[model samples]
Each structure stands twice: as C-alpha cells, then as structure tokens.
Target: MLIILLLVVFMIGTFFGFMFIKNTIAHWLVGGISFLLLAGSVTMLTMHIRDNWGMKEVTTSTTHQIYTAGDKSAPYGMMIKAEIGKNTDNYVFVYRNNEKSEKADTNFKPDEKHISEAVKKSATYKLVDDTKATVTTKTTRCVWSSDFYKLLFSVGGEQNELVKQNSVVSVPKDTWLVLTQDQVKKLSQEAPAMQKQMEAQLKADPQKAAQLAALQKSNPTEYAKMQVKQIKQLLGITE
Candidate 1:
C-alpha cells in the first residue's frame, strides 16, 4: 500500500511538472501512462491486502474449560484444555500476564507449536480472531529460566526450523490450517464436558490434585493476578 501510494504521488508530480513546462504532448502521454499505472498498482495492492487480511466476523457462543491432570506432581503439570474449533482454518490465541502480553497465532503450524508451549506453561490463552489467513507469519521469542530464549518462530507458507542461539522457523502455506466458526462453537460447547472429565480424573487421584493445588498456592500472587488480567482481556471483558 505504501509503495502504491508513493508511486501515485510520484506520477502526479511528474504529470504536473510536464504541464508546467507547457509540454502538451509529453504531458498527455506520460499522464495517461501514469494514470494507468496508478490505477493498476492501487488495485493490485488493495486486492493483496484484502485477500490476506480480510476475515469474516464470527457469531458463536464460547465456553471456558479448565483441566487438572491426574499426575500433577509430575514434571508436566496440570493441563488446561479449551476447544475453539474442530475444523477452523485460523485461530489467534493471546496470553497476558503482569502487564506483559503475548499473542499466539494458531493459523499456522509454528503458531500451533507456540501456543502449545504457552499453554503447557500455564499461560492464559485468549482467542483474538477466528477467521482466514491475514498475515504471512507470526514471530516471537521464548523466555526460559528468566533468560530470553534466542529463537524465533515464523509461521507462514513454508515451515522453517531454527537451530541457532537465536533461530527463526518459517511455516509454509500448505502447513497453515484455519478453523471455522462452527468448529469453534462446537469446541466451546464441549469445553465444560472436558473440564468435568479432568476434574473426575483429579478426584480419582487425590495425591496429584493435592500436589497441583500446592503448586497453585505457591505461585506468586502477582503472577496469578497478571494471568487473570490477561484472561479478562482475551474474553473482551477488559480494555
């Protein structure tokens, strides 16, 4: 868009320059070509942005799900599962904690892996947009042991693998998967059931539940409060 706008501005300046010099023939030819080029460029840019970014609004009900694993004391802690859709193409999940905000794009393969890791870390996930592919890729760095992990994941058409201290992974178009609104609705509806199942599993294993409860109790109140704030934002309940 910026490029097209610049081109249009340049063409207009050239047209006026020729007109000021009283070059009628030059003005007519250059002006005509400029006009045509401007029109074509604007159309192409508009179409490209629209095709990649335009997404339909969803009007489906949503339900939240919380899960508690049976082996809470295990290295892998309790898992919170929320079903947004079974057949949706793209899904955006955002996480916020302590004035820090993190967004995850599930529209592509890298986003899937990214969100999966976030959820495992007990970060709050919010569905921002549930529509078609908009951006080419999403990138983010991971924080590990209080030090920022120097790796970036780029999700788009071609999937890339990073192995450097600071690496980048690009996902290919064929690997991009977008979910539909109906699928999201279905997942929302089933969330409560999944939660119930997890709760039952916890009940069957009191020791595990106790361990998880202890962990939660030990978590810093500040961090928990931050997560709550993020959750509210994801639900569109907070500004």
Candidate 2:
C-alpha cells in the first residue's frame, strides 16, 4: 500500500509539475520530490523481492522415533554424541521415523555444528524446536509477516527465514544415554570386556537369560531397551 501510494503521488506530482505548472523553480522542485518518491518506491520493491523486509520468527514442534547411531537393523538405545566445547552444548542424535527402517536419520550431519538437548519423557520421541539463539545460528532472512504486509508490498510469494534450529529431543531417560567423546573412546576400548561381563551376568541367571532370548524374538524393541538397561547398570550410569 505504501509503495502504491508513493507511486500515485509521484505520478500526480509529475503531471502537475511538468505539464500544468508554469513556474520554473516550482516545477523543478516538484519534479525532484516526485523522482525521490519514485526512487524510494523502487528501492523498497527490490528489498521486498529479496526477502529482506517484513519478516518474523516462528517456531514449530514435531515428534519422531529415535534410535542410536549403529547398525540400522538393530540399533542401540537412544544416545547423544556430545561435542564438548568451552561454551557450546551440541548433540548429535540419530533417529528413524519408521520402526522397520534399516537406516537411521540424523538431525544434523556429523560435520555440521548444531545445539541440541535431551529431556526425560515418554517412550515415544518428541522433537521440540527451541527459540534460543546460538553462535551456530543460520543467517537471517525476511518473509511477509501476514497477508496485509504482502498486500502492502504487492508481492506475496515469500518464505520464512531460518535463524536457528535447536532440537530438544525427549526420550525415555532411563533407557537413553549421553556420552562425551572421551567417554565414547573409553567405551570403545573396553567394549570387549563389557560385553563378556554382560554375558557372564546373563549366564549366571539362566531364567533371566531365557526370558531375554524370548523377548528378543517376540519384541525386538523391548528387547533393545532391556539390553540398554543392563549395559547402563554394568557401567554404573544413572539417570
């Protein structure tokens, strides 16, 4: 609306100042003002086209089933590979929306920097977008705030800008784990010993081992959760 109004005023000023007015100074003054208005209109139009005006930040939330990064067919329990930094709190989460999927989906690539968090919640995974701004936030762009703003610009095809995408993944806290890089290294080095120890514990209790074997065949998901619980106990990892 402002752009159109400026254009209309420019047209009127041009017509009266050049075609109707008789005075020289008045004619040049009006023409100059009109040209300034026209320039302002064109500059504003360009900015709107470039999506650098009239935008707002919006947040949305979603949920998906999460899995650990490992074998796709039988992934470990939900875990976050934390990237330790002086001030950054970043997490890498692997997930799969489909229960039968053979591959896991990740929120960010392994090399990319992002911030994330894990919260204690239900068995189902919940992904909530946070509004906090961090150093890793993406570049800002603008979109039409509403239909009214689009009408004012006369260009309604604009998409919202992404500032940051911080995911807060909620998982069953009791079954999930967050391990740092050093801790992960230690776990990898001691994996053989831990596995043998776990096997020993199961063998010591024949009924428990049989029940786990049955559970694995009947309900693989529950079986995975049970395995994670046992590993946490062996490592003395608490919720």
Residues forming the 10-long window of minimal summed lDDT in candidate 1: 145-154
Total backbone clashes of model 2? 1
Tell me which residue pairs clash in candidate 2.
1-152
For model 1, the stretches where C-alpha displacement exceeds 4 angstroms are 1-5, 14-18, 53-68, 72-239
TM-score of 2: 0.53
Q: TM-score per candidate, in order?
A: 0.26, 0.53
Cα distance off (Å), candidate 2, residue 138: 14
